[model samples]
Target: KEKVQAETFIKLVLLYNYRVERIKQFTNVTMGASTKEADIIVYNDDTCTKPHIVIECKNETISELEFLQAINQASAYAYALSGTIKYIWITTKSKNEYFLIDKDNNIKQSIPDIPQFGINKIQKYKYVYGGREQNQEAKKDKIKQQFFELETISEKDLINRFKQAHNSLWEGGKLDPSEAFDELDKLIFCKIWDEKIPRQKGEPYNFQIFKEPLPKNATKEQLLDIENKQTNDLFNRIITLYNQGKKEDPEVFKDNIRLSPQKVKTVVTYLESINLNITDLDSKGKAFETFMGSYFRGDFGQFFTPRNIVKFIVNSLPIDYKDKVLDTSCGSGGFLLYALNKIRLKADVFYKKDEIKHYKYWHDFASNNLFGIEISEKIARTAKMNMILHEAGHTNVISSDGLLQDIEIQKNSGNKEFKYNHFDYIITNPPFGSNVKQSEKPYLENYILGHKNINWLDPSKNECRDNQSTEILFIEQCYNFLKVGGILAIVLPDGILTNSSLQYVRNNIENWFRIIAIVSMPQTAFSPTGAGVKSSVMFLRKWNIQTTDKYKLIKQTLQEQIKKESCLKRKNRVSARSIEQPYPRDAFSN
Candidate 1:
């Protein structure tokens, strides 16, 4: 893409009447220990003795930080060259920055544009508005400028931009890492919102920097003030855009932009040019996931499930548009998003020719069928933002404990979709190694697995335990959320399956669900997330009402028959012992 950008810029230079022979692409220059390739180097004449300008072309989706790095790189190339290069031009397809370099004095100043071929004098800016309506006096000298439209970028580039923007906010601990992530999410939301706004082809975006024309004799102080004001104005626009998004979907974020004006500007600079609304759903979703995965793996790894595992679980399920799906411990919404993607791919097959129908088919599922619950408020918001980036399904993701009662979850989350036996599929990797104490959570008593000394044959003997491992309770919770015959794909520690002490848990699972499949995962499966426990992905189908009732009746009848048989045996043994003992005691003594 950078090579393509370079070629395109060369065409623009040629339009200014520069000779093709004088322009060189991939010109190598030595910078100390190694050589670097300059994207484009322009010479004053065909002789190519004097290097006039050094131009660096980058992909249009390049982040502001990368663009600046490119600028420095271009400068280094200029200094390395034997000839004195007077100007430096750095450009992406959508943005351009020009600089005037003084090598002897080691000074570089911002200039609107480098001079065109054969024009000894530089203008305040090149490519000014040139038509009958605007700047008529400069028509003869200035070239007509076209506005840049937002471009869709590749997933790799999008991820880089997200990471760069996030790093800039918290590089020096300006804000906590988690706080930085939140702020970055807010800015990205604003960027997407800005892209969705209706606009004509040539209109500029509200999120980008637009410097007003300044006086040629403007003082340094005056210039500083103008730049500061521009930053402030851009910050205000971001806030306005964020507010508008919040108004439409208030669940995405509850907090306002807390970064200083300058910090907000830094983030906006990276994202302002990309058209996130039109970017491929898979690309955007994965980009956000990758960016989030790296950050979360540091301090919040417990909340996140690896994408490979998430994909595996989602793919294994027979999910469709009509099925209401859920991730009880939906850390960053990995399962829900993957489920959404699955439906989207299905939509592509059925509605290949009809875009409108295709959109509705999958979008309806995202809007209505997908649901998630996250205990951490911050991670829940992250999950909501993750859904929003995927384009829908955010409203149903709630911040509350997955094991909470339906009413409590609904009340706490302000989303009424959570209910027992509601979801068609429950897919999640519930957090492991954590225990939910009966004292800490009153809802623990509500879970069958939460009890101690449970009698598989009788419910009356079940007593609530003081504490239960979370993974144990999540199984019951997933069962509660799933409808009869609903599918459940969950990740569990292997201890639950192999440990002798947890046979009761295994029994409870049998009572609740019919085992579908248990896939053994390697020890390293969760190592990336800082968990070393061996685990397995278990697929189960909940029992229907009739099946459950019939099983209970049969179990009760079998228990009664076994008890009767035991009683008869005991009576027979006692009769035999009494006859044999009397003969040995009283008769033998006589």
Candidate 2:
């Protein structure tokens, strides 16, 4: 493997027309100092007048830690060599990394990859502006202008502007709080769409999507006509993109934006200058969730799970690429999105770029494997949209009552139902403090913990309970959804974990699952949403039949012994007393 990597490095050098040598040894310049050796050295001449570059080669299977070690080794040799090396290259059979040296003889920065000798194909990227002014020279100037624009505006300013537009809709009674958010969502979508789709060349640079720019030379009436026309045209184009997105993932978007020209102008102006796609997903999620938190504080608070807790719970689970995952009370899709991100992180290392089928790797996993159930139509739509923005199409998120879905699963035991015992992992923050007692009989009949049933090892005791809390019911619901050996991570109220009255809940839990980990969250975990209840995140693995069969056998033997004892007592009493006289009615009853 090393030989192949070395050969590849040498060939790269020759292809660049640089004289190369396989440097087998480097003599120590000072006594008591160790010598250094590098895989290959490229020089400007055969005499090695100036070692132009040094290269380090490793096997293709090198781990990231080993790669870092190789970087240090390469750096040491470059510094120890007689002449200052202009560049350093580290190569495995499948990959390469390059670093540029600074005036202080330190690795200043890393580049995409080493540049070929004469070609110097490496080039920095710049934001391209829309309109007729799109020639290279014009673009260069526009990039300079854009730098000034970006420099003048901060993230806070961007957020404030977004809020300002949203506020306009609500403050003036133009739209309600929910409608205001929906409008903002559409406008933001349009802004993102504008950034992603480039404008045709020879068109005038129109910053209309962000804010309408006035015509340089026009009458007041003409200006009004042109600006209005431009705004309508941009919005129409955005609607077309929305239609396309619906075709790609039907669950993501809802109705088209029904904004007045003036309303569209307000939102566009407030958001036009920013690019949503370029921002990192973490930063975007944080900012957007924070913004949503305020709007969602009252009615939608239950759906607002803090991202910090979401991250903690998602990271704690051991997820795999092909595992079927579900967030059965998926509130705005925090758990599902985080799990998807974690799986993608593993895939980034496990598979090469060309080996991946983009649609199958991303869209299919989201559509087929990652599932969510949200009850509120509005919030469910929001969850779907959130998934789409994260590049995970939300095809599998069902907008219906989660409990109803579970009931259907219970009634229909067909394998094709794809409801229960199907998920490899179930992570959720189900609603608590709600009663599941309204439909008590059905729940008791359907759920394991809801009924009074015989003990697994000893059938003498009744182990059933009634009037279960929704959170308690969710525990069994999550378990039912998990296949044997599957994992469940749920956030529950502390009362369920600690209160003596709920010991039966724990007992039932133990009977069905193996407790993996329990983390107590702060009392303020949900305080931002006005919920001060202390909660904890619990992780459990489902127990298979083999693990519970021992208890079942013990229960069977105990029940049989109890039956025999009663029968023997009856026989003894009847044979001894009934023959002598009219047996006491007490003995007969006994």
Candidate 3:
């Protein structure tokens, strides 16, 4: 916990903006007659605009004692700045905590001090071409001049090619890649690089099936090989990328793998797990219940939660390297993976280049930092695939009912390693629905702390038991999974927030958690559901709702207290993949 020096502030600016030349740090400047308002004030820009960002550092030993000193200093500067600005970000390197103070009324919300260059920023990035020729056409023509070769590639080939491109670009000198390549552009790059046989469209998207999906009458060895390939490939790619990125950016490796929303779907559709007789289960085409509820009969409904959404939730949580993060509803462990991504991102952003050599020693801080529990076999497998994809396949992702508090089975008859009270952060979008049976009622209680006698502990009365509500169970499960001071960010249906059905429970739960910011979502966000339902994303955290006054305050004041939002126009958002066609052509079929 070194004091945040002049150099530390410069690093923060660099992370925020990619095209930075240098930073000038100022020191203990005078404030009012009684005291100096800030430890440091940094002036920087995002290339196009220059804005002054004020930061207060805790050069003193950062125990719980110095938290207030840094915060108080930040508050004074932000209060003064807000008189003319919208927001100011403040942080302390020792504790690694960052928060944004709203200038209007100084609403201070603690944000995790993550790396400035995160996957979210990468997604928002669009490449700008510049050349001596000067002008849009010249810039485009210049980039186009470099090369364009479409290597007729399989999904596996696409990833490998990206890996090669990644390594090549890193070696070439830390360049930012343009928006990800389309099938056409990738081929063009290959051709420009002198690959004579680039594949063209209207042809096969090659299948490197690890294990052949044998015919209906196929034998056992045929099945075994398919299973082997699926599992082995799943394991290899994650470690390779993790190690590769470590060697490359080592600090910001996770920052480079950018995917748009559509690209996210592309990767998940390609992520396959060896499920025995999975196709047979779809014979009836019956809709089975999973976390997100009755998805399609086959693999249509399951996709990894997009990285941007995960990044949003991860940033909202109060997490650090020391905090034990858990995802009771870890879908492909997307949330956990992103949380780890944030931790690593912060380490890269804040620590010095030389200090970063201690990357491995931070493994335990990153490894044991997350935990996940999911129930659906497909989702669990998908989560495993995602964790591996994100290179956190090793971060204990348990395949079990998230709704169940802790369903004790025979724990190998002698496992003393299970600890119940270790988690510090929880972020997830648990399944949404209301048709479960009472047989799983106890699990929901354990899941969301229904029996904890906290004022927020409100379960649907047994008199009208509707255990069918997976969303309700998830709410409970998340509440129970957290330590007393832990935080959570959950995305559930809008109904759960304002639905009159569980007003009592909602009111009670409000006491145990604080509803931070609710980002109302548009309907088109979800797929066509076999079970028709509406959805919205909610962000809340665990704490006791001790008094009825606090409950009434949150309820009555929510609407007025919430800030109105203007939705981004279509052009700013990601395009739908279905408007054209999806990957694996006939892969999600028989």
Number of the top TM-score candidate = 1
lDDT of 3 by residue, 1-590 (tens): 13456546565554343234323344344356654545545444433223344566654233333555666766666565423322244443322334444454335543322223222211111111121122233234322211111112233323332333232333333343322222212222212222112333222111111222223443455545554554455334333433443463222122333333223222322221111112222221111112212222224343345445566667766678888877767765657766776676676776663574445424555456667666654455445434433334343665556554342511421212224444677777777654556564544333332332333324233243334467766676667667666676777777777778667567656766777777876565554333234556666666754543576666657643442221333433434544555577788898
lDDT of each: 0.81, 0.66, 0.45
Q: lDDT tens digits, residues 493-572, model 2?
A: 99998999788688778777889989998888898788899999889999997776765576567768998998999999
RMSD (Cα, Å) of model 3:
30.6
> Can you tell me which runs of candidate 3 are displaced by over 4 Å?
1-157, 160-303, 350-358, 393-395, 407-421, 440-466, 527-534, 544-590
Runs of candidate 2 with Cα error greater than 4 angstroms are 1-133, 137-161, 172-174, 193-241, 256-258, 347-368, 406-418, 437-445, 452-467, 552-590
lDDT of 1 by residue, 1-590 (tens): 66655555665565355788888878889899999888888898778889988888887656657878998998898888887688888876445667767676665666545765666655432321111233233334555432334667889878888887887788757579999998898888888788777764444577765554445556667666766776787788889999999999788888898999988876765676677887988899889999999998888889888889988989998998999999999888889988998999998899873589999999999999999988888888889888888997688988888888999888887888899999999998998889998888888888878877667656578788999999999998899899999999999999999999998789778777899999999999988889899999999999987777777688778879999999999999999998877654466573
Error of model 3, residue 436, in angstroms: 2.6
> Each prediction's TM-score against the native?
0.81, 0.60, 0.41
Please state the error at residue 297 of candidate 2 in Å: 3.8
lDDT of 1 at 471: 92
Deviation of model 1 at 111, angstroms: 7.0
Cα distance off (Å), candidate 2, residue 329: 0.6
